[model samples]
Target: MLNRYNPHAMHQGYYRYPTISGDTVAFVCEDDLWTVPVEGGIARRLTTSLSMVITPRYSPDGQWLAFVARDEGHPEVYVMPAEGGEPRRLTYQGAERVEVVGWTPDGDEVIYNSTAGRPPREVVLWRVSLEGGLPTQYPYGLANHISFGPNGAILLGRHTGDPARWKRYRGGTAGVFWIDRTGSGEFTRFQPTDGDLTAPMWIGERIYFVSDHEGIANIYSCLPDGADLQRHTHHEEYYVRYPSTDGKRIVYHAGADLYVLDLATGENRLIPVELRSPRTQAQRKFVETDKYLQEYTLHPQGHSLLLTVRGKPFTMGNWEGAVLQYGEPQGVRYRLSRFLNDGTRIITVSDASGEPCLELHTPDGVTRFEAFDIGHPYRLEVCPTADRIALSNHRFELHLFDIEQRTLQLVERSEYGMIEGFAWSPCGRWLAYSFAPNERTHIIKIYDTETGAIHPITQPEFRDVLPAWDPDGEMLYFISLRDYDPVPDNLQFEMAFPMGMRVMAVVLRKDIPNPLLPPPRPFEETK
Candidate 1:
């Protein structure tokens, strides 16, 4: 969450897609193109379009700027004066993504990659002349990151860089950097190691790129033949992202701050580009909150609804009355609330103190308690008796919290998986839940609160889940995938269960008879 909005609050703007042209550093922030001096100071917004501007690149002569912006649903290439002016749309590819790679070395055309005229996943490079007209594709079919060098030499990266999705990613899809020294349509793979290699920039004689080979992503440089391998910009926390060069300096962003790395002196510095515009989006505005409403339930007596919205947990009156939102700490998220047996008290989970805690909201005030200071309570249900509550966190543990005692009891720590689909018996003494023994099977388990004993009533061979108890507490009902009627796949050599689910029941006591067993006579004979 952002802090309270102050129009004059001059904090450094969090920007991305940083490109350098001489002493000017151009980047996109707040959905607008912004420029500031390389020495770092107050920034100025370049375009008033206020669209999704990204990947801004400066022309070789530093006279024109090319970028991608989306005014409608689709993104297209656009160009404008290097300083600031009205942007001119360059590409008319309707529903494809256009990412600005850079301008040509001669500054006559802009180079970009798009999914147009190809498969949705296959991206190829294209060039549009500055004088307008149709765009033409490069000779290569599929490539992502490309940087041109002097005398027709080029560096190609197989994939673009993204820190959020591909940080420390070591898989088959991980891109490899390649170089073409002759520009004769022959490209060979360089730096064949297994790391997320991307954002290749062929600066002068050495090729600079971002890689996580040292377990942390940083800017690294190596000879065109994949030697030397000098590591620059040792960022241990945030990965260096989208490093673009303007012949002398490399501009990229790590986390939210823009940084510049000089090629000759090896100097790295943060560009503190501050903003002065009113951040209306960051200001707290009133919302209907129905859009963010989640996990709602009726009141104990069907008078109102207890629900959690984007901000906090609140109650809405069914007939007439003002909506009551419980007083909570700002930025604390609450969920899964229910009216206690008292019909006036509410119990839910809150991350107020930075961890999950049981919060009780009553007519007087609010009180909170934690369960031995562990586990995040995402699933919660009030016992019909209302003295106890059942909690299940992401740690695969089930707990019982006593409202009066303010104590937590570790009822069961599931050894295999989560203890979902739990139900409190009408008597509130036996809690029935579906517990998994392995990844493939779930068995109904009953826990006796008074006796502290557990009993598994179902077999492991059958996959069962979602346990519900009868009102009289004599039987427990569940759904089981016991019937495996397999059907062979039409496309491949595999089988799938078309209809396997069946309603299952178990008699809780030895004196009760199995309802599923037959009477000893056929239906017609009995009739």
Candidate 2:
């Protein structure tokens, strides 16, 4: 087991894009290139560029190393000797982003992917000769990463969706495909599944790849024809990312530590690579907080503004007072800071006690209230009466907490799904919320505290949301998608309803007149 607390351990983090060639493995660590032996030992820094460098690939013959560097303010390809020397610049197309895929089998050229002079969503592969010249674009349209097979066919990994953002994604563009490079534009997709698959490596008779079909991503191997599939690694904690093979051994990263898998014995072993460079990035450094302002809200009396900067809450004056930070303890995260009814006390949800709890900040200091630990709460709302708090949990159960009595109450539980868009009335005697009866449309509903009655305000014909109570306690206002003005398409004559929403107000009493109607004029007495 790797000691995570040790600073000098191989699991110090920030190592990425591992490429193996013979007995050496080159990878990017903190905007520089470094190489370690396959058996694992002290790593030697190869490039000391000021800018960010990434995606290092060793030449097929192990004589040169090609990687992407942002020295000129944009990513471009550069090649250097395998034993650490001056890097020669390649690819002058000036792309905003470029990545070194791998070297051509002959070692005289390098294959890379770039998004230059094309749409941002599209990436085209190119081959640039090591002797320095313009690149030749491959015919493949949107390939992200590629590896050449023994027969010159290309094994492509296309990211139709973001792998990191969308976990356990099983969409149309989540699998690897084989592209015949012999002028045939013929493409064959791999086995179909609803799991994310990537990092295609064609080694010998088997094609190795990474798949999350078994819950967590692990190394898997299959034949060239997508037959005889087998799982190689059974890691369940962290996903095995960026696996590279030099035909003899497979190297990959699992939870910040590199592991090497011998193809002959199928034995996986950890490679303890000790980094000798100055650990400048792990040290503490000062950062300007004004640029990272996230959430802000106006003060109740409009005298100041409540702002959250880098998880710390602050109050800045509208015209007079200076900025005052809440000065919470370090390592504590406070979210959704809100002012109570009097504006003298601030209420926020914090995880300072390990689990999330409600905290009250006032002139008397901070006081924590333990109101029925439901783990972490969301969409916390303070009542106008200042004695009750409303919130929802991850399980979609709405709750109400009595501040003074230190008691909890279950407001409403959704049997169909989650109930959202809840608001308190001015008198704090009722709560209005919206939920979908079916899965099609959301309807507004009101809950009365005095009568304990729940009834729907709107029908199921349209979706209504964001309910707000009128200050006079006589009307309710909400947004509804009832307007259906459809615009015809110019090319196909198809009608498209483009987000027609309107604000609507409903009188709580039956005797109330329409607010938008013209008022009646008084008649003069017959004189």
Candidate 3:
């Protein structure tokens, strides 16, 4: 069976690192690539990696997508079609912490950042051809996220302070913004400030970057020569993170929502993204439960076993048979699962509706009974003949529950220790069980439903325990130490009754005569 969630449910998660091309805004979400319209409508997923995809950049022609995916156990460069398809790997150096900055203006190579040199301390920029080859290192020292100017210049952003990390960090190591007025390697700081500045981009003639000089991270722009510094956005609660532009409009994410800033009209509006992807990782994952398995109960028919795996109920079959796992809502813990008589419905004890209850499930739906007032149950057995169930709790109490009326009635309580075993009669009117009265001796007793009387079937002198009813309900079987065959020890002055245990049976009705006895008495020559 396919486990699927609500496809029509619309929710907004952390929409991060958006790059815009035309009216389509490609972004990173759920650790995969997704694209939504700038006008804000239903979003479509591009990749199914679920493997920490970051920094998606659109090609200049808006035909291909370049991003970084760690699906292969490490971050590497990968590119796919803008409309969603199988992504082809471009970089396979097995380098650590690779981030795709952006694509070259010509759309022939992808630019990214990684550790450089032998020891690899300072981060530098490298570009790899889209035709699959080794990446060539860019000459500028200490440059990560770089963008090409409209007039063939360089707008390189160095390390920037994260407002999400350090709120008001204005000290050194904040960030350094470098500008290359020409294509030459010469670089200089663009309007030095004490605040953290990152996410640099070059749209048209303005140099845009994120800064926190005003105590809150927002988008700011300046001319190429570091003149006319102006703040464009006024975000107060959350700092801006990873803003990208498509030479016309800027797409970025701040706080938990995505925002689009139009450089032409200077209008920034919040884009309500309708993100509803099949997040399989959140629903399915590997879990080691061999050491965590606490209990398992074999079904009465021997076709399956009721298992409490990590406090959840699952039914498993023998050898290549199917495994049926019951589903529960989020944050609900279910335990102690069993099948009712006839094996049509499953019964489970859960705390789902803010209180402890007994949940009954079948093909139709679920039915809950909140009057299940038992605590820490050790055994939950449904009567083999009726809708009633037998429950034994840690409080040394036995409870009788009605399935139809949703009522709980106390059957008995053990003052010395817990009730060892219980078996319901075929008529569902009698319950036979064994319990120790004082730690020294245990006896079997039967409770009659028609008459409110408890009858003891064995003497207290003999420790009779674990009474079970025959299929006919006319006889009872128990284990006792009545038969004695004492033997003296050779090395010590002690005698041990090694052959004392014997299976004992009691006939309830004297009318149950065995005709096969006395050798059937058929050879009397009555003919």
Best by lDDT: 1
- Evaluate residue 141 in candidate 3 and report its C-alpha lDDT on the 0 to 100 scale: 70
Tens-digit lDDT string for candidate 3 (447-468):
8756857888877787787788
Q: After TM-score superposition, what is the CA distance of residue 470 in candidate 2 from its true location, in Å?
A: 3.2
Candidate no. 1 TM-score: 0.81
Selected candidate, larger TM-score, 1 vs 3? 1
Let me know the TM-score candidate 3 reaches against the reference structure.
0.53
Q: Report the CA-based lDDT of candidate 1 relative to the real structure.
A: 0.82
Residue range 1-527, candidate 2, lDDT tens digits: 22233336454656777888888988878789988997778889998897998778888888899999988778899999999999999988878768887877788999988898886667778899999898999877788777766656667777732344466877666655554544255777665344687777788777787888888887778777777888878776887877777778778777766777777777777667788778777677787866887777777788888887778888889988788878475688878787887888888888887888888899999988864675567677778876777787766677787777887778777665566678899988888887677777888888886686888899988888888998888899999988899998676669977768999998999988888898886687556
Instruction: Tell me which of candidates 1 and 2 scores higher on TM-score.
Output: 1
TM-score for each of the candidates: 0.81, 0.78, 0.53
Q: Looking at candidate 2, what is the lDDT of residue 60?
A: 80
Tens digits of per-residue lDDT, candidate 1, 1-527, equal 11122323457567899999999999988888999998877888898775789999999999999999997568999999998988998889874767899888889999998989776777788899997889988877687778887778888777654644766787776767777887776888888345788888888888888888787778888878787888878777888887799889999988788888888888887776677767766888888767787778888788888877775777889988888778664778887788887688998877887787778888888887854654866577778875898888787888888889888898887778887678899888888888888887888898898999999888788778889998899999999988978899786689987788999888878998887786576557643
List the lowest-lDDT window of 10 residues for candidate 2: 1-10
Q: Give the TM-score of candidate 2.
A: 0.78
lDDT (CA) for every model shown? Answer: 0.82, 0.78, 0.79
Predicted candidate 1: what Cα RMSD to the true structure? Answer: 5.1
